[model samples]
Target: MPTSIRRRLAPLLLATATIVLAASACSSEPADDGGEQSSPSPSAEPTDEPTTDATDATDAAESGGVCATGDLSFTVTEKSQAGGYYLITASAEPGVTCTLEGRTVEAGFGSGVSGDVKPSEQAEGEPITMTGSIKAYAGVNPHSGPQEGGVQFEEIIVSAHEGDMDPVSLKLPGTAEVDQPIGTNWHTDAAKAVPFSS
Candidate 1:
């Protein structure tokens, strides 16, 4: 080959080699970045685990367990409205999670079922779950009849359901007039706890 031909081919060959080397280096960088990016993927997966666990916790709250009498603290207050009634608030104990099985509590003025408080609402309500700051509310109207002729009761025996093994005896905030005592279903909202028979 002539010297001029060699000279022209030499520059072309050198340029081609440099382009190949640059291309190889650029390709290698992305592979290293991919390895670095993969390092945090495991931690990201753990972050998603908490979200999944939250869903499981919600499922447990829905169908998990009933609240034992010992798992709650009860407070009875006199509600001035709705022809005078008793507002019962049940609060969950610390770190306790449980559900109220029925819409209304098994409540009575005395020991026998004859004194059992009738439910004002004909249709039972959805079960309410109590946890953390969540609370369940029920309203008891000691006398649904005209206020003139009603017996007096000092305290009410209450339970989460009928025949509950661990029932609670909550004192009335005031002397309640007792006749045909009626109660509302357990609800999250205190306003919905009015024990009106209508």
Candidate 2:
């Protein structure tokens, strides 16, 4: 071949090699799909459920605790037996679980201890847990003394003990003649709660 023809063909061959290399590089590069391609993150996703510890804490707060005066409702039922005593029933409010601390309820017709009824000599029992419809009974013998005359009251104030908060005032089923009013310790059994002064 002639020297001029060889030089022209060499230039064309070099240009063709450059074009092939460029095309290969373009094919090796990744294609863009119009969005970022990255690994999914578990922490980034939103969650609606609470942790187990949190749920347990909420349940404990809703259920067990010491019984405050506000957690109970008191009702006085007049009893014809037992020398005309009043059966003071303490009922736990809705969804409350509370510990009954004292053996007796602090009951009185007046605000002071002078009007407070005394508890009987019955043995103090273990603390009772009042929950859901559970109730405790305390018997109060109005006019327990042999005095001919006594104070008349239509309502009675009741508390778990002295200094307890939110004491409830409950209307008696009927007017009571209170002299030396004596009360028995709170008992789950009505027989034990009878204020039998012996």
Q: Pick the candidate with the highest TM-score.
A: 2
lDDT accuracy of residue 114 in candidate 1: 51
lDDT (Cα, tens digit) per residue for candidate 2, span 73-188: 88888887777788988879887788776476678887655578887755677677898777888888877777598778898888976688778888888888888778887778
Candidate 1 pairs with clashing backbones: none
Compared with the true structure, the alpha-carbon lDDT of candidate 1 equals 0.83
Given candidate 1, what's the lDDT at residue 46? 56
154 in model 1: Cα distance from truth in Å? 0.8
Q: Which stretches of candidate 2 lie over 4 Å from their true place?
A: 1-62
Question: lDDT tens string, model 1, 1-198?
Answer: 999999999999999999999999999999999888878766465553457778898878664588778878899999888888899999888887788865676789986555678989888888777778988899988887654776677999888777679888988887777888889988888999999866
Worst 10 residues of 1 by lDDT: 41-50
Q: Estimate the overall C-alpha local distance difference test score of candidate 2.
A: 0.78
Instruction: Per model, state how many residue pairs clash.
Output: 0, 0
